[model samples]
Target chain A: MPTTDADTTFRFLGCSEIQEILGKQAVDERQLAELLEEVPLDSVYYHTHSYFLRSRFIERTYPNDFAQWVAQQLQDHVLAERLSVVDPFDFQSLEALREELISLIDDHLSGMRTVPRATFGTPFYFNRSRILEVPTGIEVQTLREFRDAISDVDSSAIYFHVFEAHLRLQREENDFSAWFRGSLKLPDLADRMKALNPYLGSLERLRSNMLTMCDEQLAKSGRG
Target chain B: MIRELEQYREVAPKGTIDFLYRLSDLVQDKRFLHISAVRYGGGMVEILRRIVPIMKAMGIEARWEVIAGTQEFTDVTRRITDGLQGREETITNEMYQTYLDVNARNAKVLNLDADLVFVHDPQPAALVDHRKGGKWVWRCHLDAGLPHRPVWSLFRRHVLKYDAAVFSLPGFAQRLPIPKFLLYPSIDPLTEKNRELSRAEITQVLDQFGIARGKPILLQVASFDRFKDQIGTIRAYRMAKKHHHCQLVLAGSGVAHDPEGEAVLAEVQQAAENDPDIHILQLPPEADREINALQRGATIVVQKALKEGFGVSVSEAMWKGKPVIGGTAGGVSTQIVDEATGFIVHSVEGAAFRIRYLLSNPSVMSRMGAMAKEHVRRNFLITRHLSDYFTILKILSSE
Candidate 1:
């Protein structure tokens, strides 16, 4: 039987983003690299992760703002391709991701004979977002309820529990995995949930994977 | 009749209505007052009509008011609006005094005691000078990127008093010390102009307009204004028509009274030169169903505006599953994903090239159309607009 503790129940939270301009502008790659070092971590997070929230229709060619600016504005496809491959989930902190971005730009700058810049009007402006978390009004105490809630909640809810809980909360694992292991006493299920990466695809795909994991666990334990 | 928040559950994206309920619960006690120039006949009024009731239904104390102005006040405000949009307009000292006098007169009558007051556009902007107390926000709906320095310098002093400002696009926002937010204007999906139409109804409206069938329809729905560049659109259509057999529909209203609108309409007519394929529709302002039918029946939509203030027609067409070839103005480029949902063109040649390319590839056209509808669903819907406002309100309440 599952524990009846209130803390053990998973409260699904969804987020809405309010983008704010930070007044930091960069006209070139070197300028961008320099600003990247000084911008708040929220700006970095906003550029990399907010794309998933804002655009759910088209797949982005370059995932991050830095890569997209270089590719579209500066026309540096080589640098863009390199920057696109540096996934934010691979780094422990946004600071680490910032360093990796600056280093890559520096290396690309060294190989080039002349510096490249965007047009006068199309400079990259640094922005940050304030994320307001709203409760989904659905709490799940069992794996079956979790699976049902996963299908019912919004994509923002999935993004919150998986991505934001992992990075912003600095949890060792996502909220679902942590809940499953600590409360449900299911280490194997937690491991399965932890291995799934949200950065690989859309939030819909991540929700499907999480549901599949929950279904498998329920079936294996004969509780579904 | 005011719509209940639950009524939007059918049209809104999944969980959005519920999310709004949750967000609204946080600020049910606060008062939100929206003050603008007119109570009717504009996009701002239409939005306020829907959102105020919806916000009230969500349990927020939301109300809307319009500022009263004299003929001189109206003339001065019009010139100020044109000046903000980078148009050449003369604003004398008397006009500035008239604008302030009208605002001061209206501020005395209107209630300025709300916890959050949203003073929209330049007409009622100076009402902040009479702000009793509360967090005031200036909402500019024009393309105010490059304004006349003297006018901006005078008007900008009033804007400085606001706690924050909201604009439709980053490029449209002026450089102010206060925080600025970019919130794209949205189209109500449940409205008569955006509701789903039957095939027979669409055919009836098209046939009623004398627009022929069996040819690819490239439509641009905009007012008869120089900034809309209807002549340029006709030129692009002519260039594309050499290889592909297509018809161009330029449908709009509000050309009867305004002299400039009449001149632009005449210029467009001259460019068309009685071409049978080009359909120039002088629709009445209340022809929402016809516009909806035209958009639905169109194979591709074009909005090649040289300048715009967040083209709502672009979103209207995109909502009907049409691939839009938009220009890099106001929020056209922001709405169209550029080769994904639709194509973003810079010039007449660019618009013509994309129109030809899409006409040649039917599969790409359908794909882009599907993506365009989804993009509008995600970004430009009334639900998302409310969500943004609630987010801002929640943030400000906390502060």
Candidate 2:
């Protein structure tokens, strides 16, 4: 499809979404390979894992590996040149390095099909059933159908609204299971979501799980 | 000095002046000595200039003292200021020694003997070490919650010696051993900076600055500090300009106590180059009436500081009945009630969004401004601040 202002192709696709989309027959394998190659190694690692010794592993120990991976896999000579100038002994936080990598990836994928990236705020998973408001008794056939249902709504806005609502509810009442059940009118879906332990997981984990659930449901519907 | 407390009674709420009088009577013969770094420029000095005189008028012996320091000392303290405001800066041992030496000298020269010695900011905080007698209170005007560790450790040593500590907001207060007091900074409604300016005066000042009255004005008035994030303000203006036809005015002056102001100002000027709509006004220190006029004339006022210390300019603009878009830092959150008086923004994009939203909704902007002025009147005026100080004095004296 030709890109327009309303296009979500330019927006960041979570790691799980990228994996699911890449598995589909519609996405070109060569393009998928190139996209995966261009994505930062550290981002991929952080995206897949739920927990790690961040300070010791990512920040204090991984700049050299990151630089080498960028040079070898991404093949961005300009970024490689910039990374070569950085002293390994110099203290750069993992958060700063991750941001730099994300910026590089974002620049590379500015006009690409789907940008595999991580973002802040609550992911669409927890709020998807609430925001999309699929009519009662109409089962979502596939993930593509779900994506098409709310493509016009900005994900960031949904994330902020859900996050704000979550914060507001947290101050008054700790349990969101009841609120989610009441708001969405889907007790089973709310139970499944509450089982994901939204409060215990990081935002990235929550997003990944949400996107993974969508992929699973779509695959089960014989759409993959 | 505005001599009579009754003069403010006309502008303040009923019984406010009477309440201050009562508080003053409680501490009738007490003496106070306030020591800070600079005598001119910055909010602390401007506040003390009006507050000390009013305090004296209330039959209390109040004195203001400015500490002496060299260029090197000021530069070190400026870095320390940045460190305290959550920036990571390495303060060498020599800088630490020089700071203590300057404070030691000031302690010897300045009068430390008083019923209460109120030391402001990190500059003269170490003066508590050289205290001969009397209860000492450290009035911290900066955000010290997430300070650079080494610099904070040095200040913590001196800060712990004070009898009490005063912070503008509860969030700015650290885990101190002393009794902590929350005192929001205030604006003197009768001063040239906050008093109502006539339309003619506003237009004259706007004309002097060559600002156009045809378009809406988005203004940010703050010193050229990195933490003030002037560059971020410029970026936000650029983003907002793409959607709305408005002019941006960034007007401020660097104080003598801060050494990084010139560099930051130059960076801001460079960022604002070739943009005629962005007026970078480096006003003189005595431009109080001009500032008043600018605030009065602004369509929306913004203080997008990455880190702030109460930001009395936010209060000053709010007092002039202008809606403010302040950052979520320091005491700014205490002044701006989000979605009511103003919006608390987190990023440049957020600020741009707010500016665009406000420009598109003139009625909402006006309503917000009205609410902002009322909020400032009730919570941020000098009368409330004076009452709080008296309440603090009563507590300190009894202790």
Q: What is the C-alpha lDDT of each candidate?
A: 0.85, 0.65
Instruction: Give the number of the best model, judged by DockQ.
Output: 1
**Model 2 residue B102 lDDT score:** 97
- Please provide TM-scores, in order, for all candidate models, with all chains considered together: 0.94, 0.59
Docking class of 1: medium
Which runs in model 2 stand beyond 4 Å of their true positions? A1-224, B69-79, B86-109, B238-243, B254-273
lDDT of candidate 1 over B337-399, digit per residue (tens): 878888888789989999999999999999988988888887898889888888888787678
Interface RMSD of each: 1.8, 25.6
Among these predictions, the greatest TM-score belongs to 1
Q: Candidate 2, overall lDDT?
A: 0.65
